[model samples]
Target: MSGAKLVQGNEACVRGALAAGCNFYAGYPITPSSEIAEIMVRRLPDAGGVFIQMEDEIASLATVIGASLAGSKAMTATSGPGFSLMQEHIGFATMAEVPCVIVDVMRGGPSTGLPTSPSQGDIMQARWGTHGDHPAIVLAPSSVGEVFDLTVKAFNLAERFRTPVILIYDEIIGHTRESVVLPDRVDIVDRSRPNGNPSTYQPKAPAANGVPPMVAFGDGYRFHVTGLTHNEHGFPTTDPGDTEALITRIHDKVYDHQDEISAVEEFMLDDAEVAIFAYGIVGRSAREAVLRARRAGMKVGLIRPLTLWPFPYAQVADVAAGIDTLLVAEMNLGQLIGEVERAVAGTTEVIGHLRADGEPITPADLIAALPDPAGART
Candidate 1:
């Protein structure tokens, strides 16, 4: 706890969540992500938090969401099939604007495809799986160090935005152990509470940040909240005009402030002809490739995403200026590369290096794909 320690990504997630004041965790132990729940079971209660292994992933997320409504910093962990089951409840939390975190240690899948394998296959799922037009923040960590930092950031972002935040991780990063330095609890941001009379308080009323004041069930406010479109008083509404307005606002809250939510780390990109776009486990390799290429006098660079949801598109475009090419590497066939292409515009030749065999790509794998623009294509 004092200095850096060797730890796995999933274990670091549990540690970071606990430090962020997560008091309740309910999750199913699925491959890749099970270490998160396992870590919580062993440590949560010691920190005055509660941890329960539920009947299934559906029940696991349901239980955590219930705890969140009761004013607890709650979370659940899962992989592919389990994430599929939690979709309905994820929608419930989104519609209700519940503040919570969901740790998704991704694996190869459509349905139980490869349990012990890795994949960025859930990139779109994490964004659109829950149904409806709700907006939520999602973070992807490339290293075990980020696994700690981003997990805490997810909780803070969820509470600040009053929405569910997904901490998406891949199996390669989740189960891999690395030395990580824990920060001194970087200012936890909790939702502002209503200070006036409990009788006059309205849970449905939006705060200055567009987040409504939330109190536990046993609180004297006892305000009503539902998944349906509601007014300031938390009642269901059938008015499409009003519903449309509210939905737009929800999307704006996060997207409009993406500068604050999105983050990325660029390496040697200031003078490179080719840029490799990567994230999660593949990013670790991408970093090495950048260093290797620079040492080899290849003049290549890297762009690693820290925030996947509110993607650092503008940053990418800025770095891509005058660049000759972009290479996106990932465990999935191609997911985030599309975003990189759109961000780079027509200034560069965009391409991709993909691995879909449920295994992580190596630094050499991505480096070998970097095209020498001055020398022409392969």
Candidate 2:
């Protein structure tokens, strides 16, 4: 477990979840994401955890949410169609302030469009999948090693924020095999449990950090949880003032700490005039394009967002300010480029190199879109 070994992204996700203290998993099998469920089945029992293949994705998320409420760290994995079915429960977890992890291995999709092919079409969906205005924490991994690390981070963030977290990986990364060294230990964070008298416990009460301490259902602490707007005591509230406060608290909890939650990987950006913004598997190609552009004396760089939900706007804007043009490469028909455009805000010219034909954007493809450095302003 110490030395490097070849691992697929799906398998790495299983290991990471187990290591992060995920004691329960409930998921239905689906292409490109089934491997995660398969591995969890073989491994969870040995780790003193529970693994159940639910009837469907909806039930899967519901079961995970119940287990989380009962004091177990839980997770689920799915592809595009399955992800669609779990939207309602995802909203439930958010409204109830449950802590759990959900993995989405992206494939070509409106409805099972291409089960085995890679796509980034879910970028917008992941951000706004569930109905209503809810905050989300999503992490995208570009490599097997990152898949392992980010899976652990996902669980930690979910517990820390008392909300659901999504770990997004494209089909290409999920199916691809690469060498990864398992670390002996990783920093772990557990949800804070209520320490006050059971009679005085208020599950929905506002904490200074905006994350309320959680208590288990059978712990003799009385509390109510509902998708409806709730008061500090956790009961359904009809008061306009109470409803507004509840919604604002949840949104502010994430957005107010945006700097702490956002993460981006910058490559050769310090002195570059042109840049490539990408994530997931396309980031691999963007890195190569940046190197090739540098070798040819065209100062180009790459910015890969490791945390996609918060969107890394500040870091992206900082990079955009120094560059004359920003190129966004993705496996979708320009899904993420919109975010890049908003972040840059016309300070620099933004263009996209996109494909939905189930093929990855290559280094040469991104290079071709790069503006001529000799004529571009630095």
Candidate 3:
């Protein structure tokens, strides 16, 4: 937590995984996200862990799930198209309740999109990328330093809830050079270990918080885990009651304790009639807007959500209560802004400074959207 060095966003992600006790990474090299694999190759081995380059995105995701089942803190990283390729496996991890981290460094795309460029186009995909009605715990890190912090939190959330956690970042955040202060590994949280005899342990036994103690496959507990909804004994269940209970618990455990999961940063929002809301690199531009708006005597503010999923609805809603015009700005064409609308209802007019080109959202882009915003900053 001392000296800071300039590092790429992908490498910072690797450090985050390492600090979070992630020991297994199985991924195919994809632009933007490829640096995650690259850094893991050089770092995991030195930490007495394993790294693998699977043949394809599907295999990469599948192998990571397998590693998680085998009792390792596992993860895989990919960009937009690769994220598309891993959908079924992501579904597999979700249904199976496997704890692993999937870092999607977003690039422009419908197919391959923009490989080396930044885009927030995958916002919806991350929400419902996998097939079915499972819940997602997605984290978006706006800065290189934040990418490291949130990666550790992503693993903790995944392991705690027994689900696949997605760390969504844009190409801008993944490749940007910034100074990040590394944390001591001891300060990070590791997954809870089951505290019982291997032969007698039960992976499906419900705990007070709905999270069953996790034991790696070879290390101890012998239990069945499948994508199929299962009984408390871990065997697939045909009972409608059984399926309902499993799915509900998966969603509740996270939703119930949202205060622990939701993270955001506020900038000069107090007493402002208008505010700009955003995250990732877009937030930086919004920050600049706040500064300029304040200098020009305009009552404007900014709200940046560090965690995208488990959506910061409550926080955004609370802040919206005091504002008149709430502007939502992002690199995507009004994706997150809709969430702002949902939170604010029709009480606040939410303006959008939307973008879809393979370029970073700039301060000029946002300030240009508002006519005389700086003049009203007083």
Candidate 4:
């Protein structure tokens, strides 16, 4: 396992979490994502970490939050239905500013719709399911190697921002095995700890970086943690100014760091007139489709986003400005395409190659969605 081992995407995630200093895992096993929990149960203890099999996804994230507050880098893995169950806690984590990671290996779902199938139906849910005006950091990796990389990045983002970060991929990517030479070490970011007098500590007071320094509950720092609108002291408050400041600060912490948090991979886009905007497993298909379109003398390219939240609007707008058309391919029916259209802002024609029948979008499907070569160029 030291060099270029063939690893499933879910396994890579567990390895990356461990590499990122994740010392706690709490989750209920579900299809596609179960391997992550299964591997953690065996690997975490060996790495001097703790693993708990919770009764359900809700409790899974709750345990992760507690562990994180107790100074452990914690995470949980689940699929669509389980993800739905965890939304309330996700919001609580966001409001409480708890640092944790949640891996959602997506399956087809409105209500346990397809358990063993692949679908990108949760794209919007990852950002909006928790409700209210909240900040979100969600990463989607297309390949096994990238899965490892982004999982590590997810932890770093969570710890740096003091918020929950989600790493999501479809069933295909989760179960697929690929040879990857994972790095022996990766840059890890831990939550900033308070160094001043514990008595004067304000749990919700942010530093210059817009993130509050955290002190573990057992570290002799006494501070209240609640989901209600609280001031810098972390106690519940109903004052208009305090409530507004609290919400705005949380959202600004992420938006202000958009440059560091947003990641997108543009493939052969400089001279291209037509672009494919895809992510997750569909991104792989889009990559192949771009190559095929190039072989056929078409100016095709790809915009594969590694970071799903914060939308990468500027990146998409820059690409859209120069392209004649942008094709959005996803496993769901038009979830993120609207975002693309909004970014495009009518600068170029936007079209969707969508599927939600528990099937993966293939290269041919993306290729077919492209305009003919003769009409593609502006």
Backbone clashes in each candidate structure, one number apiece?
Answer: 0, 0, 9, 0
Each model's C-alpha lDDT? 0.86, 0.91, 0.85, 0.94
- The alpha-carbon RMSD values of the candidates against the true structure, listed in the order shown, are 2.0, 2.0, 1.9, 1.8
Tens digits of per-residue lDDT, candidate 4, 1-378, equal 557788999999999999999999999999979999999999999999999999999999999999999999999999999999999999999999999999999999888889999999999999999989998999999999999999999999999999999999999999999988999899998899888998899999999989999999889989898988899999999999999999999999999999999999999999999999999999999999999889888999999999999899999999999889999999998989999988888889998899999989999888888999596422
For model 2, residues 115-221, the per-residue Cα lDDT tens digits are 99998888888889999989999999999999999999999999999999999989989999997797757889999887889999999987798989999989999
Q: Give the Cα error of residue 41 in candidate 2, in Å.
A: 0.3
Q: Which stretches of candidate 4 lie over 4 Å from their true place?
A: 373-378
Candidate 3: which pairs clash? 108-113, 108-114, 109-113, 297-377, 297-378, 298-376, 298-377, 298-378, 299-377
Clash tally for model 1: 0
lDDT of 3 by residue, 275-320 (tens): 8998888888889988887777777899998878888988898899
Of 2 and 4, which scores higher on TM-score? Answer: 4
The candidate that wins on TM-score is: 4
What lDDT is reached at residue 144 by model 3? Answer: 86
The lDDT leader among the candidates is 4
Clashing pairs in 4: none
Off by over 4 Å in 1: 373-378
Whole-model lDDT, candidate 4? 0.94
Query: Candidate 3: misplaced stretches above 4 Å?
Result: 196-200, 371-378
TM-score of each: 0.95, 0.97, 0.95, 0.98
Q: Which residue window of length 10 is worst by lDDT in model 4? A: 369-378
